[model samples]
Target: MVNSWWRRSARALAIALLLSFAAPALAADDAADEVGYQFSTDWTGPHTAVWLRHLARFMKKPDIHGLEIGCFEGRSSIWFMERIATHESSTMSCIDVFTDAIEARFDNNIEVAGFSDRMKKHKGYSQDVLRKLDYASFDFIYIDGCHLASCVLTDAVLAWDLLKPGGMIIFDDYVWALEKAKTQRPKVAIDAFMTVYANHIRVRERGYQVIIEKLAPRSDRELVGKPVVHSEEWEKDYEKKKKD
Candidate 1:
């Protein structure tokens, strides 16, 4: 009986040591899986997927506050909600004009694309209202609504103001290709903002999005420069292989 008891205690000690060594790695793997799975649900397409993988690595640290400008059907919003819910200490807010703000531009195409119903369902700011009572305030903001330059610019400014210091502001569709020949693309607005506020900005995954740590006062010297473009060496190689 004494021998059996000694062996049981030894087994328990061994298990404890194993857990002490493995816990951190297990936690890291879970965090990585969370990022991959969450991003996959929000972003599709090859380029966006690639960008998201890198962005996930950057966001391993938990964000205290979060925001999303376009909460279409709440796919991305749901992702943020999960993050906030799990962390218990984080907050997220979302905004959307929801009903196709640029009806004249993508009306026919949007229907053909089968996004009409989805757009219609996004008509209200219900998610944001619900979240206000559900979670804490946001520390990160994501802008994905109103692709038009003017509207995007306005949202960007508002998001900047809303972001807390050390918070991140993310702009979706910042590098979108526009159909209008006369109107400038949304990138123009993003570039204009970055041109004046480059120091606070960091290009994530080759400029698919911009991450700003906080909003700061702009200066003439800062305004005079242009937006910094991230090198696309890997992307170029990938494209070349696809062509080949």
Candidate 2:
């Protein structure tokens, strides 16, 4: 089991390394690359193409309703529109807190990609936009919002409420670092989310991007073999929240 963990880590690291070198080589005129220079953006990092491929495999069907928490320059949004939400009835919603030129670029990029009418753009912090959404209405959700531990955990819980049964939620930047080794960034929050919700969902893939499928209603036996982390401190926290 330890060897398996090491093997997955090694493979993830190798893919990360390869992404940096190969990102610039993706065909510019191809269908996937025609949506501006999103792939080249510094905010995208190296493993974007890999993430898109993963989304394709899991969300290949067209006409699905989707949500993206942080659209940034719309790289991942366009990827979803082009790859998975291709049917006329399909659409995606994006939420972001704008800064500088990113919002304008995000708009232009998705528009140029012919998704202007197909997407709903919400400008604000994720929490606000999420609150207005109908619960359990989304088929897929991609969360790349704030990196703070509490914020990420909040987004995860909210996304859980919005995700339909059998839907998938893809979390970006699971291992992001804010200040070398000082700040825990997204990992701490993601870890807490996984631990708290262990019985509610099934992990589909785990690496830089954590993907999980919300389980349909089932018997407790479904979670019989799943490992869980329990701590008295956490139990106290949970009880407090339950009372509130």
Candidate 3:
């Protein structure tokens, strides 16, 4: 079992390394360049030319739905609205505390970009807002809410249930260091989540941002004599078993 785990880890690492080199080329989108977006900060720019563009190629469908955990000034949110969520049926939802007059700027940016009609703004903590969202409804989920490991883990776990099968989840700032302790960083929580869901997801990119694509539902269910389960159901059952 240990050897098998090592093999899988090595394979995943190899793929990640290869993807890193090809990421820039794969992310090139001519249409995305056509948009005249407005943003005060450049935090999300470093990522846009790479994995974000690559993601747009695969997940940009007519009915694509996206959720963002931390939207500051609508920088990354605007990218999704203009790039991936281009279809009339496509929609984007953002969760943020909107402190420090950030929401006004976010709102203005979205409005200026002509994406106000397609966006849903949830002004609250991610932990609270994510709970109220629909499960398995989002084709893409971007987590950049809190920098702490505990908060990051909570966001990832909650977001997993909200993501549809084959959906993509992007965790930002995997290597960020606001706290001195390693346990306080987002990498620790992201690594833990990845380790737990290793069998259920495919790691697509590993850099400043970590991207994973959901392969199967985390809960279990059965249909037409076939045994199947979604991850959310499995989590509930696990909790119930623990209680019993």
Whichever of 1 and 3 has more lDDT, that candidate is 3
List residue ranges in candidate 3 displaced over 4 A: 1-38, 58-60, 218-244
Question: Can you write out model 1's per-residue Cα lDDT over 138-206, one digit (the tens) per residue?
Answer: 466677776778766776665564555555666676666856642456778887877766766555433
Put down candidate 3 lDDT per residue, 1-244, tens digits, no spaces: 9999999999999987876554323222332222433345667668886655557664447888999999988878877776777787889999999866788878866875677889999999999999999988998899998888999999999998899988999999998874569767899999999998887889998888899998886444522124655699899999999999
Work out candidate 1's RMSD over C-alphas: 18.1
Tell me the alpha-carbon RMSD of every candidate. Answer: 18.1, 14.0, 15.9
User: Worst ten-residue run, lDDT, model 3?
Assistant: 24-33
Question: What TM value does model 1 have?
Answer: 0.49
Residue pairs with backbone atoms closer than 3 Å in model 2 (clashes):
none
TM-scores of the candidates in the order shown? 0.49, 0.69, 0.73
* Top model number, TM-score: 3
On lDDT, the candidate that comes out on top is: 3
- Any residue pairs clashing in model 3, and if so which? 218-230, 218-231, 219-229, 219-230, 219-231, 220-229, 220-230, 221-228, 221-229
Ranking by lDDT: 3, 2, 1
Which candidate, 1 or 2, has the higher TM-score?
A: 2
Model 3, residue 190: distance off in Å is: 0.4
Residue-by-residue lDDT tens digits, candidate 2, 63-88: 58899998888877776776667677
